[model samples]
Target: MKKKLISMLMIAAMAVSVAACGKSTPSETPSETPSETPSETPAEAKDPSEMTIYFLTKILGNQYWAVVEQGAKDAAKELGIKNLVVTGLASEAEVEKQVQQLQDAVAAQADAIVLGPVDSTAMANPVNDAHASGIPIVIVDTMINTENYDAALMTNNVQAGKDAAKEMIRLLEEKGVKKEEVAEVAIQIGSSGSQTIIDRLKGFYEYWDANAPQTWTVLRDDVKVNDGDISKAVGFTQDFLTAYPNLKGVFGPNNGSTVGFVTGLKEANRTDLVMVGFDFSTEIETMIREGKFNVSTVVQKQYLMGYEGVKQAVELAQGKKPATKLIDTGVLIVDLKNIDNDDVQSIIKPGK
Candidate 1:
């Protein structure tokens, strides 16, 4: 009878947790203020040893995430942030697992959390739980749904998408793609529900629709390809080829799917197509050298993102109010003209 009563109490607590997860409205601006100094230490926070920061990202397998992880670790070292840990989702689709990671971090009495939300809507409950536990949460890379967090560091994904699309349009026009022939472009996205992914797709698609020649109609080949899986994405690309014989341009919002799409191009013997993707991956560098595709991309300032995210979380831990929110961590466009130059190489290199 005693055990049954305890189990009932636990079940009731879990129910309350579900209720807290209810929808949170999206914000045009993050709740916390940004700091001017990219200071070496958590500015005016509590004792360093008492501070702990947990960083969570979307996928674990990619080199991109590896860069973020390195940045977080380095910040902890610089700021003496105790018990600092960085973690990522096992797969892109693992939203629930990612939320659970945040909840567990709070249960461990972490002082603060630096978050990279996979699905913004699904993040409210866990983040609220952390807030209720008196643990500060700082969102980075992507925005979360609630205003209860500290600050966010993000890229202007909409602009990045337009940059990529505009470059592709220029390439097509340069190649003298006649005004009558439509450019059958396809976008193979990494995750369907993520706000970052959605924003990227929206920006690119909107630009392509408005700027491309009147004859060029956007290919509605809406394929959800895994950013982590080389093989599955390659297979999806294979299917796309068989279906769209007139395919012209291809785009991917994340690095893994970009590499996978490139593999598909090589397999189908369609290396002549004008393909543009996000991220300056190793494959992109090699292809640019070989003149394979007029390939170019928008590079995110991920290292700075890593460094600043942890730094801010620590500040929040110390009860220091940040001066800024929506820290637009910057992006740059890479193309054939400058792909081999020092600036481009610097962007592609991580943790520099």
Candidate 2:
């Protein structure tokens, strides 16, 4: 990353620290990480107070995105961005709605746009159009297919998947799950169009294949796609429990899918299955505390995604592109042992 951009983002990055569990990486202090050469260094960019920055999210009213929205709002307030418009579809499935929002941002002559794409491939053209119109784009949480954006900040999801798999292995070993035992693990995801979830799934599989016991396998035949619907996630959880008597573990790569695992496991009154997944929620917290089932989650620095995304946008608005186009905000592994640790608490329930 560029020297100036590093100076701009380091203070906030240092102030927030996310703790890790089960070999997951904690949030790192900003450093001069090497990345692609700077794309553009305009002689002059818009002033923060004169800029109308738009933060477009994947969905609203969801805890994960809600926190992200709050982070953007807080950054806008902190930086004194004159017009910060935060909006998104009510559901992650609304790719067309997000596309329209991007078009509107261009039509409105936005100074910059921070986006969480609903569909990675579908959103690329709209993002490219906005970029073509000279709107600096900073992507958060999810990725678009094109390379037109000014900066991107998100978790290293593939590594996160490997971390989740490692945690799952630990839990299974703790339960005396024999290495040679024929057991099945299932995978659940929210949106097939989301490269974020896709990368997480990829990481998990690659790691599991290389490291897991030969007899243990991911139930690829019945891998469930919830399409961002929590209800469907819950139903899929029930199906996994009912159909696979030898199911020893399951992985939920997003909030809804993980919550579904928690709820469905409880409803079935089954505690024999070890569950590893992503995100933080009350349901997940309660289950961890109850110790009814084995559970651990990979919690992304979502707040940082929004906060840093805006900072990146503001940098671009000021004619200084981020030194690095891609920033891995890192993640924390939260499980029963360290749920109450200060660093973990700060992320799972910030400002509490």
For model 2, the stretches where C-alpha displacement exceeds 4 angstroms are: 1-45
lDDT of 2 by residue, 231-344 (tens): 999999989888888999989998888888888989988888888878888888889999878889999989988888898899887778578899998999998899989999
Worst 10 residues of 1 by lDDT: 24-33
Please list the residue runs of candidate 1 whose C-alpha ends up more than 4 Å from where it truly belongs after superposition: 1-44, 350-352
Number of clashing pairs per prediction, in order = 5, 2
lDDT of 1 at 79: 82
Q: Global lDDT of each model?
A: 0.76, 0.86
Highest TM-score scorer: 2
Q: Report the number of the highest-lDDT candidate.
A: 2
> To one decimal, what is the Cα RMSD in angstroms of model 2 from the true structure?
16.8
RMSD of each: 16.6, 16.8
